[model samples]
Target: MSIKGAIKGLLATLASGCLAAAVGGIVVYAHGFSALASLRDGPLPPVQQTRLFADLAAALDGLGVILALLIVLVAGGSMAWVFLAGRFIAGPLAALRQALGDHAASLGVHLPREEAEDPWTPEGLGTTLRGLLELVASREADLVASEAHLAAVIDAIPVGILAVESTGYIRSDNLAARLLFGQTDPLVGKNLSALIAPPVHPGIPGRGKDTALDMVTRAAQTHETLAVHCWRDPSLFPADVTARTVSRGGSLTTVVTVHETTERRRAEAERAHHRALVSAALEASTDGFLVVDLDGVVISWNRRYYDLLGLDSDVVPRLPQAQRYERVRAVMADPDAFHALYDRLVNDPATTVVETMHLAGGRRLDVFTGPFRVDGVVAGRLWTERDITERERVQADMARAKEEAENALAELKETQAHLVEAEKMASLGQLVAGIAHEINTPIGIAVTAASHIADEARELAVAVKANLLRRSTFESFLETVHDSATVLLSNVRRAAELIQSFKQVAVDQTSDERRLFDLATYTQEVLLSLGPSLRKAPQRVEVDIPPDLMLDSYPGAMARVLANLVLNALMHAFPGLPAAGTRDDTPDAPREAVGFPGCLYLSARSLDDERVEMRVADNGVGMTAEVRRRAFDPFFTTRRGQGGSGLGLHIVYNLVTRTLGGRIEIDSAPGQGTCFVLTLPRRAPEVPVAAPSQCDASGTLGGDSTV
Candidate 1:
């Protein structure tokens, strides 16, 4: 039974017991049965006055007593039951009320289970409350655990997280959010604007600025995502924040999520810079370079590449590779050849291909083709073109010039040989003429003396036939014969000596034979042979040669050198002057001698160890600096049209140096005369020196020794 029902039953029993007791006491008082009540003066009834009256009185008394006792017992028992029952019921009810109240306060709900059918019963109330309290406890524990797990999940997330209220304050923030804002303190209850930059509202007109809280509120209301820039003192990070409105208990809170975009932005900027660099490099290239993918899609090209193919700017880097190739092939001089070459480059990537293309306007281009590689594998083809027309022309010109120079050199050598031989023959002819002139004088004298001796002999033969033999006639005949004979012998011997000397000098020059000979004697003999030419000039030849200076060398070359020098001096030193129209009737002897005293030529030699030093000098007109510089040039001369072959000194130089294995030097100055110094070895070379060209006789005479 319920506590209320039990209490009600107890109260009803108590009321009934009280009523019975009250009735019994009334009966006793009315019948005058009690001592406290006075006996009523009322008469008894007829039947009751009889003999049964006494027995009836006894019965009534006993029954009255029994009933009184029973009523008392019933009342007392009912009271006791009411007190005990009330105590038990009241204790449980009070306890249940307090427990329900405490649980309702903790869980924020009303007390008691509203869905119970008999909540007034003690068992029902107790059972309902126990189930409610147990459910509340389990749910409370689950709520606590779920909250802790949620907090853990939010904190563990990599991206920054924040829970903000509409009041512009942060309700909560994760560790990442604190770090993103560069905050060390707790972020809860802090103003959102103070941690991050104020959000920008670009779409809002007239209201140019807004705080983070205001923007976040707007994002929540509009259910939109916001891009915000935040700074952590020295570092800046861009964040994408998403705001959501959470409604609970008729109120709203905003949940914000933050994501950083710094690295992504930096990567985009680096890619932009790399693209700019590639563009700059392509523009700066000199050669025309073209690149295409393996599928024949044009990937990159430069302006030069367009120019080489005669392509329009709009067509490059936009056309397919096959179309571009066809366009270029159409303009080629040999279209079929270009097609073959292009096919080879595309199909055969292992070998690099090169070709020279000749254009319609005589233009030449060197084109090179090779594979473009990514890592180790070929990905595409590369083409580079360069013009080579000018280079080829320059090479051709150089070759032609080299051939012409070779032909000219050959002709020069031939001319030089003829000049050398001509100079040599001229020298010999001069020697022969001078020797012939010398022999004629001696031969003429001998012939005249022999004729006179013959006449004297004829006159003596006639006188002997008449027998007129006398001492005076015989004596005259003898005197004439002796004088003629002596004249004939002297002249004949002189002619013979001249012939012998001439033979030796001529043989040595022509034969190039080496012999040991006295230099002093050779010098005297050469001077004698040149005497005929020397007599025409007013010059004195002085020889200061050492008589004992003997040399084992080519005497013929030596004799030619000496004769040329002496004849040169005699011919050049004295100027040809017209004879005086009339000789002075009274001539001063000293004046005549002074006027006729002309140039002086000197020849000298000395010995030093195994070499000989010979010098030929003349006091004649000297040479200038310009004339002395090219003194030994083969065909150089100052008097080109005046009988000068310019080979006199050249031959002398070659003979002394090559034939005689020696050196020669010259010293001269204007108005100071000239000198030729020769340094020769005592022994000549075994190899014969080649002869030079024949010469003009006039060229040898009166020529400057400088050449």
Candidate 2:
């Protein structure tokens, strides 16, 4: 307990002790009187009385002793109770003092929640103390937060802030100051001159403390600050510094703000470099270029613009756009047209226009006007002007040359057509010769058989005149006559059949006849008619067709197509191999062999959907890509001087497409051989125009096939 409370308790204990002593004395006195009275009023004789009195005295003594003991007990109990109360109160009071001292030292920081409560203190007093400590703790926390926020704000500032004393010592500096100075150590107490070098340009004075302070003081009067350039080593940073003096607490403090200008200066240099590059590009351009804003305000123009317009170069861009247009209009052939186009372009932001302008000096100009977009939105209009006088002249010349070339090509096709007809007539003559040769043998045999029969008849007449004829001779003569008659009839019929076959082929080639006929039978007849030429060449001619396939198409056209294809293959394929009759059937022989063993021509027909597909292929010398492309072109032949008129395939192309409603394609390469595939409808088309799908190569039909 506190000393005051302890002393008060001691005094109260003494007073209680005195009260107890007084009460004890009173009780003893009363008890003693009662005992004495009992002795005085004795009921015995003098000697008995004396003995009784002694006994009574002893009883009274006993009573007195009992009274004394009671007094002692009361005093001792009062003292002991006060001492125990003092000890219990002192323990808590001491603990409370120590706790309060610790809390005060820490400015009321929190302590362990497990500490015992001070029983000596009252509840209200403890509550009041706790509230006060909490208030102090909250204020302390807020103070710490505020300090941290202020420090962060200062650190985030871009410019360096330095507060220096007039004595040249750095009193305080923010984070920016240390960063700008490239110093990580504490800046306080360091001399200001030691951190930064002197200003390079002397015009910016007040770098030293004395001069800076003088300037700062003068600036205070003028309400302006002095600026200087300071550079520091190790980081070679150039900073712009401004200083002003402030009077605080009766001392002069200079507050300097430093701003680094390196990045700004670098950005300015890059901008200048880009401007130079743009200027060079504009000057080097051949076309006239002009840039105008959305308001028709001319922003810039290159030198070529004046040169192209034949205007004076002295005109400046600052002139209004109207004045510039008027100057340009003086040389325009139609000024109103230019004005109308300009207005249209300005109103419709998305439209770009290109026009040719005929100028006063006969110079042609190609002018283009379009929107100049920046970031996907139209900002202005850009005009580019190019002179096209020479280009027009060259184009006119090329047109004339192309017309001449076309005329020459037409004449050449006419000549080739005649040659192709001549070739067909020559082929016909050869067929006639072969037929004549075949018929001559049969006619000669028939003539010899008839002559023999006449001789036998004459000999029998001689025998009858001589009268030496026998019945056996007559019978033999009859038998001989029967054999001769039979032989004569057979030979004559064979000759007539040969004549009929040749006649049918020749008539069909000259005339187009559409009739229902078996394709296999007709194809066989056509190939058989070409037996003479096929026999001369060491080549295999295969006819693959279904026997029952029938078509109501122009058989004449088909006959011509097959004949022309066979002719082309024989003449172009196996160029150096001599005519060696029919080829041997050797399936394993290489197709590319240069000898006579490899010459093969395949003519196969198959029925496609509602049409017939015929393929004429050869394992002979094939064409290159260029040749195959122009293979069906009129008068286009690789063998110009060697009897190749180039119209063979062309005629075949026409017959397949124009006569019969079909498409034809030629697939050929240098050494791999050539194939001509023709697809015809079941019935011939009435219209005499070529089918749109016909072509000599891969998917393109480049020419007309009309009669």
Candidate 3:
């Protein structure tokens, strides 16, 4: 039962006991008085009556005194009961009211002042206590839910999180912390120093050796986030740890947080490596390289840059942009131009400029300037300079040499022309001598016949004058005259034919005129003209050309080509044979005695409507492979000092290929007679007639050559 209810029952019990005692006392006194009155009235005299009355009066006084005593005792007992109730019940009730008010105040609820100050009542006190208890229960539920949410949020964080106490014990840890440590067991209650190591410090004993507990204590005291290294079994990684002190129920606790930095550290290492590589490349370059930012500040430069400008390396990097520019301009031949170029490059960052720079010390440099970009955005400019003084000097020397070579070539060509003209005149002179010798034979026969006829005629005239001539004698004279006349006419006609052939051959050999001529007819004429030289040689000539084959080409060049081939064969084809115009001592000498009776073969045929093929071959000791390879080379010969000009076949090759628009090839081997095959166009290319002295050895006289 409640204290107030128990006290109420006790007060009621006391009141009932007092009332019962009062009734009992009244009954006892009245009963006693009645008995005394009955004894006095039954007998007696006046003396007995007076005595009884006095006794009755005395009894009444005593009864009244007893009743008064009873009243005093009862009143005193009630006063004592009231004092006990105030001391035990009302005092405790007042203390209970004060406690309830304080709890309400703590929960931010105010209680009315009258409620605390009023006299204690069980019912009022019970109602107030029940209302305060219900409000406390509601607030407790909200606090539990808030704590659960905060724990979930901390666990969901990706960074490793650890809440450690000041004594290094792990009070709380998240999934990230467990994963980072590579652990599956609970981390709580474990010493933080056992899970993670401190940062390493070389060369300093005991430095950076602080345990996790010590670090946490220090961090809490200083209110700072400390960076440290943590161990995950085999390797150590970077981490940031922070600690704060919190008070819970009058006790101090520290909350510590840890964050890993492995990726960030790796990225920083990679960037450092790349920077080292770029620095090495720049230093290795031979050219001067410099980089400047958009604000005209020097960002970087290689050693070559300072070396090229003759500037102090240690001082240049510390100088301002304007001062650096001024120092460089001092070494330039044109300071104004250098300043202008710098301004232009800074203003137009996207443009690439290349130009030459002249130094005051007579040095030339090739300079290139372009944008330097970072992350695809133009942030600065780059300059590259290379020395080119030696290159320019070499180029000037080469130009002068080229001019001198051209002048020498022109003089050589003129000399070659003179030699070619002289050679042509020598061949013509030979042709004239041969024709004169042929004409002399025919003329001698004609003269002999005329002399015989003159003798016969004189004899006939003498007989007629004497008038004594017989008929037989006159008839003999007439027959003799007719025979002489026939002999004279035939010889004179032979001489005239020889003169005409000589005239045509000479003209054709000296001029480069184009004409249409039959192949067979021209070949025969050329061979006839070379008769003097051919007859003197031991070799014989052969011809096999189509009579109807025609060509509209340079006949003069053709004749010269034919003559050179025939003469070359006669001179070189037959060895171990007597020289020209000389004979063996033995009249009956076998053909083998003259070194294999050589024969020169000349053949031609029409290849197509616009082309022809010609062959000049010999059946004598042929040329070797080495000799034939260089047969068309200028000034090459086997008989260099034996009256062989070596130009005989060379001239022939040039004339056929260049002047006549043909190709000539040599086919020969030792002891297997040589053959020169020529393929020519029927209508030669139209070109200016080159003079004999103007033979083009380089084959540039005509458009193109196939030799």
Candidate 4:
């Protein structure tokens, strides 16, 4: 497509056309001239008699036509040759132009051209043109992609975005920005808050009319960015937002990140409430607690901890950069003790210690120390100091009481021995009748043995005196005397054994060893202990104990309960016949002999799988309902006088209910026998000592149990 190539093609065509025309003209002229010469010289073609004018004109016209025909043929051949030459050259020139264009492009500089830069030339210019078209197309694609990315990023963020021009005109606003400002006009080219718009909330950005416009104007004038926080105060609760002016391609634009702080505010309030609860608990708690850092810096101290030691923030020592503080140093004494413990745990990583600290002011604390782990790594140490001072004091008192208790036990044993002796003496006085009654049989047996012995001895003497008896007869008579004497000794020993068993029955019942005793055995034993009062009953006292009945109970307490009830029967149930004449006597014994029939009954049964209930009912003048209500009360008794200690039923109630964790009920009416029904569990119950009781309370037993 270059001018040189076109000119060459034209020239070649012209040259070819000229050469062909010249050849054709020469050949045609040569052939015609030759024919003319041949005709003039040899024989001229006869001119026909074809009308003088027509013939002359025709001959001339014929000469002209032949010449014309010759010219036409030459022109036609030249045109064809020119056309062929053009056709042959045009395709090559075009291809050659293209190659030259590609080659020039590879060189990076435009190649020198002579044809004044042909339009269709195959040179660097064509490559430059193609490159320009591709560049323009790529720019269009990039512009589209950038717009898409900007839109995506802006919409994804919660904060509204905007771009502003130097003239304070809004260039663009994202969806969020438009919503916040209550403008739906795309906000572009609009002066923010300057033009007519809706009313603004207090917290809305640029709240006052023209305020935002003035701010933007000032910013443009000053060429500075602005940052501000605002809220939409449509409601009492406001939505707060932070707006920042950021530079975008040399222009300042506003971007806001919105936040609704209601939830965070509520959570903070809840945390405050929890902190208040902790503070209150610390204030009210009896245990002293402290929260500290790893270095034992006191972060928090509760009321008890401060109150007990007379220390508070006012009195607490403040010493910075010290290995240990004044208070802790004074308390610990050893400068490196805390560090030693800290190192012990830090080094081994699995050590803990419970230490007993004897602090100042004669106080004590059980301090437990351990490592604190944050994210499964040791970050600090936590120390819990319990004011076990009370427990220690109690333990000390208990030890002292134990020693005193041992002494008391010894004294009680001695006193009981003496009481036993007194009772034995009283018993001997009472048992004199029974002993005498029983001895009559032993005495008769002894007397009969003695008589038999005398006879035997006399026979032995006669045999010896005769001096004529054989050895066998003398041996037989001596054996008879020896056997009689043995019978008399045996009778005396039997009587002594009965007295001893009766005497020991009361003391032996208090032993710790328990036995499967037939109720009969225990009843008889208690009766023998109370042998002195048997004759007080006018009628025979009836005992109805099933032969096979057994029970589980502390027989010592049971025996005592039986004895007390029986003693009550003797003293209160029946009125003494004063000398069989007067209604009253001058004085009464601890146990008075009754003038009426009185009976004592003791029974037991397996109330359930794990327990037995024992009963002791006495056919004595029973108590009224009012008295029954307070029957177990210490020092409350129907028999106010006659040595009633009044602790019998009270002790029985405690032993059964507290010790056995069982219940005791009393059913009694005036003039009827009182029945003490005990429903006892066969297991022990664990419970702390109870609180002390107030005096004069109704239906109370014994002293308050230990708490």
Candidate 5:
């Protein structure tokens, strides 16, 4: 039973307890007092008459005196209890009744309180309560059903769900709601207004104005359904509250549903930010990209695409997307297949490329169309186009120039071959010149000797015939002719030796021999070949080649590489200081170095029998850091024309890096001359060996050489 019931039963027992005591006192007094006679001077009569007369008299006095007092006392006491029970009864039960009555009165909602205070009285509000209690007792089934319906609704809510009456009464709240509010039960039937803490600001609503109070209040007043959100418990979480105000039988109430939105809102914000980032990235792209739907709607086109197609966005937005796309379609190089292309783009399951689209301003675009998917289903096309017109122009220009270059290169190659031939000729010419010089001396000597021998013979014959005597003199003449004859023969043999040496040098220079040879001898053969060009300047030739150095290499290639480097230095570096446009700089030396005579040195050492490292260096002007940066760029030559082919170094670079499996490096400065170091590896480095082995010229080898 409720505490109220137990307390009420105790009060009823106490109030009745006093009445039972008063009645017992009255009963005991009547029995004891009635027996005593109050007639003090009375005489006895006959036995039967006296007994009857005496009993009658005693009864009358007892009745008038003590008996009467006892009777009156008992009656008065019983009457008082009957009257005082209503007033002296314990108040808690009555209070409960008042509470229950208020609760029932505001069953579906809170009610506007009456202005007057209720002076509780047994005859008035008490009578009304008793009748209601009797009715509840009479209809237990209906009351139970009402209670269960309310309880069931309260149990179902996972989140905090609450209902409040318009008068600020707590109508109902679920277990979660009570726990969230940190309370045990609803303040059932408590005056909602009395229980509510006053608003933070007087006359103006604060938390009170929030849904918990406001919607209930407003609905009660206006009889409208009001929905709102509020935080019921600030400590646990900011509750996403949805409140719906309602009215029932002139009573107002509001139901509140509180949901937690922390995770969901966070996820939504993150996705939104990612989408913004993607859009920004697309807009910032340099490539032209656009999207089209299966229905031919122009969805998104990057700014570059707009510019590429020469489209005005302001004009495009006014037209239907289909019309705008029609305008865009006109720019497709293959517009005839645009519709088909679009269909394919939307339908294709894999990536593919579409080529050469025409555009405004005589430009060509490269269109890359891909499928746009929505919900895992292909929806439309995402086309990315680039203006490849410039690339085409570059290709065309390169093709023509390449044709001219090839012809020129062929001619140059022919010239180089001829120069090689001329080199052979120069070798032969050196031989011829040497043979001529040596043979002229011998031939002159032989002719003079022969003439002298004839003279001597003639003299001997003349002397013998004229004199006809002197035998000693005739013998002396024969000896003189014999000596002169010996001298002539010796000179002829010397001429033959000179001719033989010339013939040998001429033959070896052109012979493609793979056999190991003396470095000094091969280098001399190369020098002999270079004699034709050297003779022009008549420059003094220095030969420092060691005779014992041996290597097995393509002598022809070695000869050619050396020739190119030497000729390049001679023709390019000190060509009169660039005719005043690029006068050579004699810059200061580096702060720390071996010495100040910035120079290029040529030397060779035998790495092995299979390899020889020939280093060619010069003392002319050198190259700077900037020059080295673009030094290897294809078709990017510092020497514009000058018959450079630009490919001179490029070809050299390729030959060393690709054809020969070697490295070509250039080290130079403003004043310090350039050194082209060719590291030829007979036993090539461990790399993937293709027929034409490619090398990375950019790879730094050993020590920094200030290249």
Candidate 6:
């Protein structure tokens, strides 16, 4: 039974005994008093009465003493029972209550002092104690669950975790801690110093002397994190370790957390390398480079920038943006303008500016300024400057030279035109002289025949007048007159024909008139005009032109082209041969023109309805490849001092190509003879032809000749 139940039953038994004792004492008192009264009223002697009273008194006193003794015995017995119960049961119950309170306090549960002191029945106390026990049990169960959850959470973390003792032993370690150490066995009860190196604190006093255990012990005492190296077998990797002290069951334990930093370290290293490369590239550049932050602070600059600006290296480093600008502006030709431009650029970050700046030393610089970005944000502006003083000077010189060249070229062109006209006039003079010589012979023949006719007429008249003339004499005189008249008429006609041919050829050669004419007839006329020159050439002339071929083009250009080709061939083709009617000692003479017989072939044919092909070829000495390539170039002559002007073929090429709208080509080789091929349009282009220049020339009707 409980202490409360046992105490209650003992108290009921004491109450029953006291009530019985009270009842028995009251009955004895009543009976003794009644016997004394009867003795006093009855016929008994005084002495006997006195003795009976004494006996009654003594009996009552004895009864009173017995009652007192019984009472004392009862009280003493109850006290003993109470003391025994207090010593055995209450003491234990009180102790149990105190213990329960302490246990509840430990479980974060508190019981009131009034509840412990309250009067309690057996059932109430038993119920209270049972409830307290149940609460303690629940708290213990919750504690167990919380500890298990905490352990699971610690294990689930990716970073290594360890529960360590101050003595450097590992009480417990998570899976990550074991993995970091490359071990599968439990790390519990192992020394932490064996698995990893001690965390180094370079800034701390006496750091080099501290061991792994000492560092860990210090961390537990100070509760600070240590960044250190962790040994992962062959290498040491960076890690962050934090040790904190925790008290459990009156013992101090340190909880350490480890985080590896291999990837972060690698990323830092890569960034550093890239920064170094950029710095090197900037330093090696020839152009001045400068970078400034948004706050107008100079962030970086290359050595070239200092050189270009003539800045003091030592003082500039300590200068603010404004002061640095002042120093730079002092060296500029326009200080105010430079400062204004700087302000404008700072205000408008998005604008790119390119301008020229003049320095104090007469040097010109090309400056370019643009915004630079970092991570898509405009962080600063980059300035680049290049010296261009030498370039500007060169450009100025070139401009002056070009103007002078143009003036010189104009003068040369005018002089060339005069030379070409002189050549034309000279050619015309030669033709006139030849034609005059040819006409003189026929005219002299006509004169002599007329004189003979006159003599015959006179003789016949004299015979008739004397009256003695016979018929036979008269017939002879008439026959003589008739024959002389016929001879005179034929010679005069031959002279007239030569004059007409000369007039037509001279007119065509000097003008650029367009006309529709048969190709064969035109070619024949041209050859006829050059007959005087051709007759003296060593080569035989051949003409194979088709009579039906026609052209509507510049007849003057065509005539000039034909004349030049024939003269060029006569002068240069046959070596050692005298040129066209000129003596061997003349300025225009050939070289060694005796061994081989020569032929000059002139041919024309219609290539298509719109075009025609003409060829002037020679079977004498041929031109070399070098000469052929530049055959039509002006002022290029093989016979320089031999009186070859070299303008003959050049003029022919210009007239045929520019004036008559034709294309010309040369086909020749050493010892193989030479051929000049001309392809011409039936109807020439209608564009106005200009006078001959150095490279290009054209001709117009009734205008200056393009020679």
Instruction: Indicate the residue-level lDDT of 618 in model 3.
Output: 75
- TM-scores for all candidates: the values are 0.54, 0.54, 0.69, 0.48, 0.53, 0.70
Candidate 5 yields a Cα-based lDDT of: 0.53
Alpha-carbon runs more than 4 Å astray in model 4: 1-145, 164-171, 178-233, 236-260, 264-318, 331-351, 401-425, 436-567, 575-619, 624-637, 645-667, 675-707
Q: Rank the candidates by TM-score, best first.
A: 6, 3, 2, 1, 5, 4
Task: Give the range of the ten consecutive residues with the poorest summed lDDT in model 2.
Answer: 66-75
**Winner by lDDT between candidate 5 and candidate 1:** 1
lDDT of 4 at 340: 73
The TM-score obtained by model 4 is: 0.48
lDDT of 4 at 306: 52
Candidate with better lDDT, 3 vs 4: 3
lDDT of 4 by residue, 123-161 (tens): 333343444334434554676898899898886776566
What are the per-residue Cα lDDT tens digits for candidate 1 across 384-434? 887788889988998898888776755665666666566656767766877
- Candidate 1: list runs displaced more than 4 Å: 1-347, 352-357, 365-388, 458-486, 511-515, 525-529, 559-607, 686-707
Candidate 5: tens digits of C-alpha lDDT, residues 1-707: 33345334534533222111122121121122233233222322336333533453454443342100101112111210111222334354454445444544543322223335242433333244334444443454566787899788777767776677665666767777666555677645544333233344244344554534654454455655333323233433333455566777777577655555556667878999998888789878878877767675777766787777878855763578668768878876667677676566546645566777775458988878777689988777777878788899999999999999988866755554554355445445655565565578789999999999888778777876888647787777778778888899999898776566445545544453345556567666555555555555412334445667765544544555565566566555554432222322232221112122222234666676566676666555666787665565434446676655443454455445554467777777776667677777654443223322112244332211110
Candidate 4 lDDT score relative to the true structure: 0.53
Collision pairs in model 5: 110-165, 168-192, 333-357, 333-358, 622-669, 623-669
Against the reference, the lDDT scores of all candidates come to: 0.64, 0.65, 0.68, 0.53, 0.53, 0.69
**lDDT (Cα, tens digit) per residue for candidate 3, span 524-547:** 877877778877776667688878
> How many clashes in each structure?
12, 1, 1, 7, 6, 6
